[model samples]
Target chain A: MGQYIHLIFPLVIGWGFAFAVIALSHFLGPKKNLKTDLTPYECGVEVVDLPSSKNRFDIRFYLVAILFLVFDLEVIFLFPFAYIFKSVATVSPFLMIEMGVFIAILLVGLFYVWKKDVLIW
Target chain B: MFGWIYIALCSLLVMFAILMVSARRPISSAVFLVLTLIGIGVLYLMMNAPLVATLQWLVYAGAIMVLFVFVVMLFQLRELNPTSISTHPGRFALLLLLGGGFLGLCLKGVIVGLQEQPVIMMGQTLVTGEASLKDFSLLLFSKHVFAFELLSVVLLATLVGAILLARRKQRVS
Candidate 1:
């Protein structure tokens, strides 16, 4: 618990700096209420679809995100095994088999995705 | 005191969660959800599970939030107008009751835990709740090995399901 006390300094300083910057700009900066100023600047181009809803993106972006999430969770689960692999292996040789099985399962998923051409796009 | 810090983090988490659900814009809601996840990660750190906290931030706040934002952008949802929200008093009351009951159960568990005496091991009180990375690894790889392996299978299913659902259907021969 005490070890984490030092982390408080960075958090405090970071948030303080952010709030200070925003506060300073709000209080000191020029306040022009022009309609042009309120609009989003897009290299002086006319804004289109700024307020319109239901813009559809390519489905592939969502697929990539899903793939990333699956692999990310797999990595997180591997962390504990990697941390204690040696110690646990000394107790029994089955630890290796256990991790192998885990990876094998995920590998099948990866193989399935590869075969399905999900990663091509 | 740690208790004060814990309470502050819990309240902050609750505030962010409320903001997440109530925010009009999908992007704002996603951002608030990230803040709520970060607050939970900090709470995990305070509880002496640094590894869990790091994973919480990495998996939930980082990867999951990325997915959330991507989905939001994919849908390209605009702000929800307040007038468009239909109110149902019965549904609201039911939700309130469910939330309150869950909160009460959690508070009761906390109260019971605080009332319990600390375990004395060899005449020295053991730090009961401290879960360093080494301790976490020992438990995960030994007694919980079955559950750990099962988690991988779940991930595999999720991966295949996600890919199958997201990918365009193949043309039939």
Candidate 2:
């Protein structure tokens, strides 16, 4: 509890600071609004249809996002493995083989995705 | 003070979950869902389970929500209109029933927890070094080793399924 109690102070400070800045902007910032200011700007360069609700996106985006989801979870599983592999290493040398096999399975999944040609675009 | 903070975080989580379910735009709903997920992480932090909280944020709020938002955007590819919210009276009844059921379960959990106290699921409270991570790793690599490998197999299956799902439309055309 002592270790976690220290986190509370930082949480309060971060949230308080954010709320203060946002409230200050609300109270002190200029309220005047111009039509041009409302319009979306295209990087202050050639306006090539700025990203908005109206623009059509690609289905590949979903596929890539799913792929990312798969591997991101795979990466997360590594966190616990790494956190205690050293401890386990001394106890059982076979632990490395276990981790190796786990990783190799995911590698096969990666290979399958690569072969599917989803990684091209 | 900690109790008050915990209650506040819990209330915020409930509010955020409500906003997520009933939001107008899909993107906004996903954003609200992220807030709810982070609120859950904050709750975990207060419980002294820093590893669970960190994983909650990194994997759930960060990675999973990114995928959710991208999928929501992908919906924009086929349709321009905002996804319509349910308006049927039966839908309202169903929502209310689900909401009430969830609230009851949560209330019951709180009551039972308060009566029995929190269960320490192993680890003699690591005050100095790594806390839950070490305990979790021991359990994962020892007790739940088979489940761990099975997760990889499931992921592989999902990868294959997703690729096939995505390729179906292209093949049809």
Candidate 3:
């Protein structure tokens, strides 16, 4: 409905170009096999650990992720509020208090999480 | 042309949703669900609601799904055994009932909203630069202020509850 065609236009072009290059290489490029060539990239350094499913991530990883999500959600909600703040403020100063209440609650959550030592390794 | 994209997005959403439910692997299910979320965002974009779409992308698809992946990794959960999942008929029945109830509620809301479109249009006409957003904020703060305040309380409870749940309980000597 809108002129959002520009948004996807570059995306379509990029994908088409990528696939074209990949296909061209597959057809025309040499398929020689070498041990060094097949080796996994190591950032020009020695590879540390080969990735496998046997290693389990620490629980703290998930905990940190959850905390990140909670605060991330708080930020996202603030976007709409911030977007219309000036106009809303002009209408009624009470509008600011509404957002203040929301932020205060999240700040409480942050304090709770902090006191609980959830952020510690 | 836009209609075709909308159809494609809807089909993608439904397909990924099905994949999310039916996939045996936890990782695959999370991935499929993320795809479904992206499809929903794209649909929102097509509908010219960039704010909602961006919010969906940032919060739901990005943050929430990142957390889900971490959860899946924490569990190190691989393929779900079909026999183990499907064997519990009672749980299955309960799930079916709950899903049906939720679906019915959604359908009812959609029908009611359609019938009340004219009333909603009064608020709809204010679509402009930031006036639409300001209008929404005013409506939310003025009309739904109580509910908004309640939401903060709910978040506070959830925060406390989550911390309590996550904390290691001390053992009695």
Candidate 4:
């Protein structure tokens, strides 16, 4: 229980600090009222709808999310490989082959996306 | 005094997490979510899991959260008009009772467990000598080989599926 308490103390301190910062900003910030201030700005374009409603997002958003997940997971493979690399240097050929297949699959997906114009900004 | 401090912090984290979930503005929610993550990270550090705390920040706050923020920015959500609170008093009462019951059970368990386990020096074991990064890497590749391979395959499948889902259908005119 004491160990748990010790662990929780710093977390409490950090949260308190963050809360104070946010509260201070809320109280100190300007409270001027204007039609323009109320309007949503989208890349300098006047927003047509209220900012909180569900809005259409570009296909790029999903594309990027997928890409990020793929790459992030792939990076996890490096963790174990790095740990045993010294003792397993002799098995480098097999490791390279496996990694090659992994990269090839990702490359094929990238090509398909490019062909479909999903990669185009 | 220390116990009170911890209770205060946990309450704050829970409050921020609730605000993050219910905030109408995506940006505001994202900011609060960051705070929640940081609070959790600090908790991990206090537990003497500095490596886990660092990973929490790097993985959740630095990487995954940036993607969330990027998506929010891409969509450019606007401020939402406030709405009336739920009027279902019975449902609210039930939810409160269930939550309170869970809390009581957890507190009872903790108190019971505390009577048996004594607190030892928290950081002494880890402070003796740091494990080499090489040891961790070796364990991952050798012992966790199947998991490592499976993750790679999953990534490959997700990449293909994402590309396929996001593809624009070409209309034949």
lDDT top scorer: 1
Task: List runs of model 2 lying over 4 Å from the truth.
Answer: A3-36, A42-55, B77-131, B168-173
What DockQ results do all the predictions give, each relative to the true complex?
A: 0.55, 0.49, 0.37, 0.34
lDDT of 2 by residue, B39-158 (tens): 898888767778888889998999889998877776654423544443444645655655566566566655655666454323335452365568778889889989998998999899
Task: Give me the candidate number with maximum DockQ.
Answer: 1
- What is the number of residue pairs that collide in model 1? 0
Task: Give the poorly placed runs of model 4, Cα more than 4 Å off.
Answer: A1-57, A76-80, A83-117, B1-9, B76-129, B132-135, B171-173
Per-residue lDDT for A109 in model 1?
90
Displacement of the residue B126 alpha carbon in candidate 2, Å:
7.9
> How well is each residue in B53-95 modelled by candidate 1, as lDDT tens digits?
8899999999999999988878877777653322434545554
TM-score of the B chain in each candidate versus the native B chain? 0.69, 0.68, 0.67, 0.63
- RMSD, candidate 1, Å: 6.8
For residue B150, give model 2's deviation from the true position in Å: 0.4
Better of 1 and 4 by lDDT: 1
- For model 1, the superposed segments whose C-alpha errors exceed 4 Å read A18-45, A48-54, B83-132, B169-173
The clash count of every prediction, one per candidate, is 0, 0, 0, 7
Which tens-of-lDDT digit does each residue in B1-173 have in candidate 4? 22433454565577667667666688988998998898798676555566566667767886678878887887777766743322334544654554465466557556755665444424344442235445555566557756766766676677677777767677213
lDDT of model 4 at position B149: 64
Candidate 1 residue lDDT tens string, A3-92: 566887998999999999999999998888998888999788877665453475677788888889998998887888787787678888
Fnat of candidate 4 is 0.42
Candidate 4 chain A has its poorest 10 consecutive residues by lDDT at A76-85
Q: Model 3 off-target regions past 4 Å?
A: A17-55, B81-131, B168-173
Counting only residues 3 or more apart in sequence or on different chains, how many pairs clash (N, Cα, C under 3 Å) in candidate 3? 0
